[model samples]
Target chain A: MDLERPLPTPITPECRPYWEGAREGKLMITKCRACGKPFMYPRVSCPFCASRDIGWVQASGRGRLFSFEIAHQILNKAFKVKTPVVLAMVELEEGPRLLSNLVGIAPDPKQIRCDMPVEVCFEKLTDEISLPMFRPVGGAR
Target chain B: MSDLARMRELSNAVGIVGVDESDEIGTLPGKSQLTLHVEAITNAARDAGIKVSEIDGVFTAGQHSPATIGEAIGVVPRYVDGTTVGGCSFIIMVGHAMVALYHGLCDVAVVCHGESGRSGVGVSPRRDTALPGQFEFPYGFGGAPTYFGLITTRHMHEYGTTLEQWAQVAVSTRKWAALNPKARNREPLTVKDVLDSRPVVWPFNILNICLVTDAGGAVILTRADRAKDCAKKPVYVRGAGEGSEHVMLTQMRNLTFSEATQRSGAKAFAMAGVKSTDFDHIMLYDAFTSGPPLMLEALGLAKRGEGVHFFAEGRSTPGGKLPINTNGGGLSYTHSGMYGIFPIIEATRQLRGECGARQVPNARMSLVNGMGGMLSAAGTLVLSNEGSR
Candidate 1:
């Protein structure tokens, strides 16, 4: 494991809700009240039409592994043991694409395929920090 | 779109005279990026028969950079650029440098990039990790190789593009690299080799990934008139364009191909007044295996799914119809992680009639497509011999 770990931020004014919800093991996606389009990388405004009328809503966190890559790279010293890791882009049940990690799949290449269904799980890192991750759902909900 | 005159007008203003790269590039053990870039710039200047002091502008690429290339090279350039798009940065540098030169911002502009990526410079676990990086590692989107693999798979699903076509890209470039010793994957590779290679990411075998060598390439651009006396023969920048939309694949409207490549290539083709089929040579960027196929589709070389067909028929290999990646490209040649510059280097050599065995005979016009980010940033340049226009 890496000694010099890189931790995420606290639930501050801008990103409080996201961190807090992750701590509660729930997924939240923001939407623009003006446009009703969902978005990831939570921000104060809608990136589509540039409307600031945004609101937070609970997301089912159910999605599919639309596309993914197997990373053999050890990004940090803490991650050396976990070289050849799998990272992915999950298209959420809501709409926006989320940059989240995948879990619960064999590291072997044949274990995954495009458009595979996955569900989100929160992994707590430091105090006040949790990440929304994904894993293949063996069967339906 | 009668930019044919405009392309000529741009060529009349600026031309890229010489291109050079550091021989001992990539993971120089303890060498810093600055030293690599300096050596590359000096080599380029020397190859162009000019002094380092003549350069007045420098452009650097990538966001997580230590400093501007000019400052590190000890030159106080009149123009300093820190255009931070990942791999395709050097390509945009050409377009931006030309614009800067057009208005008389600088003379002797040098576009430079070097990273110890293969040597692994203080590279982080991707800031998005846990947020995305660490969080996704176990589920398979491990690195760029597989990240691109995901995109390639989608392309395959939607367009009927096949794995064999993607393999053709790797095989073709390796054939070129087999001849050029600097290429990392010069060993013979076939479609079967591509199919059987260990899977780094689904749809991408080890051979499909670009070589992560650490090297720096530099190109010197000067006013058209000054280029006459600079070196052997100058390759005019006939047309150039750049496009940017999203930084990550998640944010793009679609993941199959790059809007940047589409937009940039459109503008370049329009400006050059030549269709994609007109180019005698192509130096497409291949950061990952999927970059070219998607880019080829977006750049209008092959229709969406037709890119696979183009490759399947042997249209892009050397001595083939399209004759691409003649300098072995990133797939076969030095990837340095930032493989954008090598395409330009090869294009310049082809224009100057210097690529000995690999030269495309009578090659007059060429096109180079550059990509940055996960196809977030793109630039296309049309180069031709001085009198072609």
Candidate 2:
């Protein structure tokens, strides 16, 4: 993917690992040893227990579509060409949900429903950044 | 003791003495954010029959600081607060102002909000480096419509809420807008009209979203004793609560429900010793059509997934069992970025019986709720004209 129109994520110390992992086609989540729980949106401490014993674990890259929107307007100018995109919230089997885009599926209400099975597919946007977007498993392309 | 029992001292302790808005709303081409603040605050002081020098406390949020507002308004306030939570920041300021007055920090407190949301004169800086911009914005989650649309989609999935049900909220609010002479879009809207409007995002069309217009309003609070001498009938602050559990949308406890509202409204209702039925008028922030229903459900005004029916059944519209958003709401009324103060202004009008055409008949109690940061923070106020003395 050579599109550079949309804004890029500014890698920070806390979230660098998650972005780096996406480049390597890996989905990452923060797991806390103290609470034995997993969560998304990397943070220094466990959101559940406030424990500093946090570690990065490879997510299953498999989840169900929790909910989504078929945005008719292209919010970011970079993605101006991709009008009517499907923005989705995928709830990983690990009990945490993350916001991402949905590919390999039509952006239609009649076609999409909640709890649809999906799998992560990394798409490199820049040399240092790759977004973890999801697609319907064993569904349309 | 119950929260209500413990709240007796605070209940009716601080009364809202005055409410005012900037002279120009919708499109004030030359007016900047700072000017709007000073204009609204000055008008509020005049409404209360007080002078700018007498306003010892100054409160404001969004794109401006209290120090700047105080300097501009010619007040060297003893108490100042700049709580910028989001669109609901001014509402949260009310709760803070009440606390400050209760603690004897200030006698005359003025909470103001102004935004060049439409003119883009002095908007707040974008936090692209922040959590949402870094994580969600990259995925095309740009503004309120996209995220709120996601919320509405989830709500529909969980409760089997139909698109028409969501459109009904717009229809009912438009009816109220037609009554409000100052409402931006007073034209009658139907369910089909909402459903057929330009699509901004899934589960939402242009009509389902709030219009971005330049506007601002202010509320003045003082000790109940002093309120008796004010120019307007004192609308006592019967109960107030503010809650913030998360700053990001993904971190909410539940996507289908608003925890902030649940927490804030519970405290407000308990402190007021009243239930949903006690309110003669209600004002839930309608930044999006989905907001009112979600707030209603969270505040226990409606059962889970039954909020949309409150409108579909005509219970929340004009001449219904419950009246809400009589000022046309942010949807049809003026929405200058932070809309928390607009509802406060309308609620005050209801309690004072000053709303000419849109008044809730014999209204003595009004509930006003404001939400900020993608439903991240919530502030609830129960105002009453009945038991101030």
Candidate 3:
């Protein structure tokens, strides 16, 4: 097993708030004040309406497994991930999708299904960063 | 005239005069990226029976600028395009060169591509601090296989596309590879062989992915009038189109279908004034086994959810109704990271009846579609040996 430290997310000005919320065990996303639509990966403006009146808001932290792949090969040697890691896209209840890791379950095709309910959980990586991951809604943490 | 009419007038206004690959394609560890570019450019110019000095326009994509390539090749190009939208940049450059030729911006244009995909010679080190690097990479998103596999997984969930159907593409393409001496993997393949291959990602075996090698290719184009004087048969550029959607997979409008493919295919088909049935040969980028089926459906070449049948039923194989990826494709032939130029070269060769064994007999019209990034961009070209009406 490679114990190399995983690459850290380079926090941008627009995404700092989302990372800050993750440290506090809160799921935060941006919603457009003009269009009343929510989006992810924290941006300064709403992608739907091109409005800069977007602001950060707490999300439900609930989502569905939109799509995923169980990777048996790792491209980046710095990533300290086990083989068969479930790399997935989770569609938040707030409507935007997030690229995240699906954990707390066996990485098997028979065990995972699309549209399965999932909820966000944070793992603190350092003093300032926590990654938001998802698992089956009722599965063991 | 309206914009549509003027756009239609540009159809068949330019034709491809020459096309060739680097002297040695499969694995040239000794060759640098720029060396591959120069070799392909020189070979293509020689094939066209023109001096490198006659190339007035230079177009290319990748780490190096067009000016650098033009300078190294001893050409002072008046018009140059450095459209680096990924692998499909070369295919898209064909369209740009056509417009440049039609407007007399340059008389002869050469679009070049050379990548040290496997050798890593003169290759630029990529550092991704962008949106994808910040978000997706942290989740152990392993390069192309995992990125493209997400689409296949979602397609399976949405439309019940099966693993067997995906393997069919690999099996069919290998049959074509067996005929080309230049192909990398020429052994006979079966659906069973594909299914039994090592797993890289769920729903994808090692056979499902494109081979990583080092190669370079170039295509020369000129006005239709000047094409008659070229060394080879002029493969008329009947129509061309290019488009893009999103940089990240999550931002893709729909996981099962590609909006970029549809947009580019529609524009190309419309400009050509032909239906999908008009093509005698077809070549869709096969970065993964699932690429052709998804793109076939998106391009309306096959009915929705039935694109896999084109390969599974052997309709796209040699002697089939619609021969696709006749050069063995990126899967079995050579995928030098960016595979866009190889398809153009194959289509041009097929149209000229130069393909000795794997030739599509009487192949008059051909369609080539290329995908860049992770289904982020697309470029479509409709070529015909017959001149414009």
DockQ, computed on Cα atoms, for candidate 1: 0.34
* Comparison by DockQ, 1 against 3, better one: 3
> Where's the lowest-lDDT run of ten residues in candidate 2 chain B?
B124-133
Q: lDDT values of the candidates? A: 0.75, 0.86, 0.90
Name the candidate, 2 or 3, with the larger TM-score value. 3
Give stretches of model 2 more than 4 Å off: A1-7, B1-5, B124-128
lDDT of 2 by residue, B219-325 (tens): 99998888889998889988888888777667888998888899999988887878877887889899888899999999998899998877864688888878888
Backbone clashes, each candidate: 25, 2, 0
Measured by DockQ, the strongest candidate is 3
Per lDDT, the best of the predicted structures is 3
Q: What is the TM-score of each candidate against the true structure?
A: 0.88, 0.97, 0.98
- Per-residue error for B266 in candidate 1, Å, reads 1.1
Q: Please tell me the TM-score of chain A for candidate 2.
A: 0.92
Worst window of 10 by summed lDDT in candidate 3 chain A: A1-10
Q: Which CAPRI tier for candidate 1?
A: acceptable
Error of 1 at B102 (Å): 1.7
